[model samples]
Target: MQFDRDRFRFGIEAEYLLADKATFRPLWHNDVTFAELHNLMEAIPFDDLPSMDGLELEPPHRKLMPYVVEGYHVPNPDFSPIDILPKGVEIRTPVCSSIGECLECLKTLHDRLEAALSGSGYTLVSLSHHPTEHHFEGPQNKRRYDFWQWAMEVMTTCGPDINVSLPRELNDPIDVADLHRKVNYYSPALAALSLASPIYRGKLWKIRGTVGKSIRTYRRSVIAPAIELHPEENGRMEFKLFEATNRLEDYHAFFLLWLTLLLDEGLKGRSRDQSRIYDLGAVARFGLEAETVRERAGEVFAQAPVVLNRHGFDAGPLNIMKKRLETGRLPADDIIDYFDETGSLEDVLKTRTGLIHGTELAQDSSVNAAALSRSRQSMTGI
Candidate 1:
């Protein structure tokens, strides 16, 4: 069950918070906003997708909550306030043959989605949890989310990670259990590389009073070989490690890094000690500043370039990981530092495009940050 680079393709599922620009708090008006979105998407005049990044004519149909069965959903106007996630929309990309194609398609999908959100007052943001907030709203569906709400309430206080999907064709030979083990072993590296959720309920995770700790992704590990790996299911597997990263560089770098590492036999089960599992939690808690995992991540990043270069990726995209190793400055680190300096989350999230602007750390021009259409609509209050 060797990694098949030629046969592999990937997609993205980016979750965003529908936030009130004034208070930096999460908001969701499922009735008006959801209908606006639906009607706008409904008006699009296409049956089948034309291209990965081309104009999409179809939108995911909305379903009532309770999540009784696996299905798609529209907003529930009849319900009261709920956690922004259940009501918030996730911009997903169609499975694409290459990283470039996937990203391009995502850009288009994101653009059209944002266009629909125009005049809606609420804007999309990629915060893991409301920076300084809590949810008192009831579940989206009593039957479906009741169990989830209970578990998240009973088991953990935090929420989901920035999950992505990589496609392996149905015809490809994938040993489910073996592949699952290898993937779970390496999944933590993705979280370490793409850490965007640093603050929760208005303070740094370390100091936040709510949970006594932050880093939502580490609250629990999912049942491995998540969904798409099932024999009868879709031909994709989920990487449930990363928090919400709005950067294209992080998206591209992550999937490519996964591919490279997957192919590198030396990287598989490279850690012999407890650090393999413990360090993922450390990464969630401290980003690249985690002492032990950062060291190991550096070693892996150093080796991945050779493999990435072989696959026609210039390796410049992996610069974020390199920057993290050299300086211990993941994206979350800088964002936190900036917030500490100015006491502004909106400024940091709004102005910073990716982790690659005016960067003195590594000036690799080949390292591309393809955020051509960044939304500058500031979530500010007068």
Candidate 2:
């Protein structure tokens, strides 16, 4: 399908840990202290670099309105042994309209931050989560703290302590809806982007996406809301609908549905079985939809003939589907092979029989072109 060329853009938001001016170790201080340090740095003129210096400013506290903090322990009135304090600094790169531009901006920002902090008795550590970082009793900013306090009361009742950064540049300008979808669809990939929480409290956590998991969990409890997609109105494969439904339920449900769909495709000899298939039935039992269950068993007969004519049971589609299916569940290989395999409509039709020939897939089905377009735009960052 033809795609909108103007949909690609990139931005970066980097969160840094604050440390003592004398010691290089993680520092825990109140909001006043952090604000003072931030002010001090703001007043200093530093040379810029590609990776660190291209940053626009210490991201104003207002930009982090969307995030909530949780998972880390905070001191409470009932049991207050030692004061728990945490300080953070945020840096946002210049927004680029393309991936290439974004990368260039990132390089500049990275270099600037490095040069500016050198020999300053401070450094910025790139990580999804810091093992030694502790949570303060409350949020650093009043707006964040108040909003989260109310949000937790209305939502899943969790604390907020998460931080996020986006690239400063974009290759293209994206629609608002597409932006949301991009944020939601690529969440797992973004989660994979900086999986630096391998060690928690100075011990191996044995989880690859520790920061991803913690952030997602905290989001679900504090930010995510119950929303649904109307198939007739929104169209199939819409990210908003998909995310709305996915967020309304548990991750297990989402995973089960994804696995079932893949299995159905596989049973028809349309694809190869992934290692996770061994646990399919158990996953299905964990609240999978009846439609998914039926589809899994019936897919072989339903799509078999078409799949046979299309790809002839090659592993490419299966592999791609498996990577998409396994997101947020397990550790995946690079998936570079599958990533490059997604083909055009004609390519798909030549490989799969049921697909309409020489026509957009959205046109042939009830799929919403706008939604699909947005999803693709978000996924490809194009």
Candidate 3:
């Protein structure tokens, strides 16, 4: 079945860690911050959010709540309320007909969350893993908590689940299988672009005391799929490999990248599960520094423009990704460098907490692309 890009919908479920405004440390499950935020959100009127004309608002948004108290603390039938512990909150967008709309919706919800946290002595920070907490003590009877247990009790890591709705035409088994194969092939390399988790267990992660990049992905990749269909949502493919980022432009770029891959019929690259697992490990450790990861990512980025253009979309958002490839530096590298220079995790969290909210709608692709081109030309003496 052929996909008509015009009808495609996009959304995001972004998770953030809660931090103490003063100490910049991870907030515990018992903190009053959770209840305060929840109460404030409940008090907000639906009219506070900007209205999107001609768009169908769904679920949480339709119910006037776009943000929720998420993470390990959220109680379910399997886990009693007493056993539940809060870690952070998740902000999600209603299904949107375009990438721009989706981002706008996300920004709206995030802004609301920031407003609610104002003067509450708490703030949200985007980090793939907890910077200080090495372990969390919790009940361990359920098999579902295996990864959480392995990662040390609470899954302190927070990341975005990039969702794209598949049209009914592409819901058949043949198309679904093909989509899975392509996603597996490209996810490892694409994931390397968003490696923002360099520090883990209170220090820079070291493999046998060597430097490490993303402990979250390095460990989670073995157990999770690069892409999976949302069990409850019909035809929605969730790209699960990316780490969290504070920059709105990063999400802009990532969504477009995945959408391009989903729409591209000419790019038939496929990989077995074992090969993807192997590749993901290298990426999780060194990011683009690994030659295999860089080359594989380069191929996808090179082809992204053609696919995006064919779908009547701009490829300008990809400038940030191209710059990352050119410099061989992902977010984790910058974070590690900052921590090295400051010698304080609190200092790092201070800056990141401030960036938890964003108002920018999209990347200035034209400006970015022009600047990048000039830099490349000068470097090559062209």
| Candidate 3 runs further than 4 Å off | 1-6, 30-37, 48-64, 73-83, 140-154, 170-174, 231-234, 354-382
Q: TM-score of predicted model 1?
A: 0.68
lDDT of 2 by residue, 159-188 (tens): 111111211122123233433332332222
lDDT ranking, high to low: 3, 1, 2
The C-alpha local distance difference test score for the whole of candidate 3 amounts to 0.70
| Residue 19 in model 3: lDDT | 83
Error of 1 at 181 (Å): 3.2
Q: Of the candidates shown, which would achieve the greatest lDDT relative to the real structure?
A: 3
Taking all chains together, each candidate's TM-score versus the true structure is 0.68, 0.38, 0.82
> Please, what are the lDDT tens digits per residue for candidate 3 over residues 312-345?
6678878888899889888888889998999888
- Superposition error at 364 for model 3 (Å): 8.6
Task: Note the clash tally of each candidate.
Answer: 11, 56, 1
Candidate 2, 128: how far from true, in Å? Answer: 2.4
lDDT of 1 by residue, 208-292 (tens): 3322223554543332122234234344555555666566666667665666545555665543224445766666776665655
Where is model 2 more than 4 Å wrong at Cα?
1-7, 19-24, 30-32, 39-86, 139-194, 205-221, 224-382
- RMSD of every candidate to native, in Å, equals 7.8, 16.4, 7.6
Please tell me which model should have the higher TM-score, number 1 or number 3.
3
**Model 2 worst lDDT window (10 residues):** 240-249
Quote the lDDT for 370 in model 2.
Answer: 62
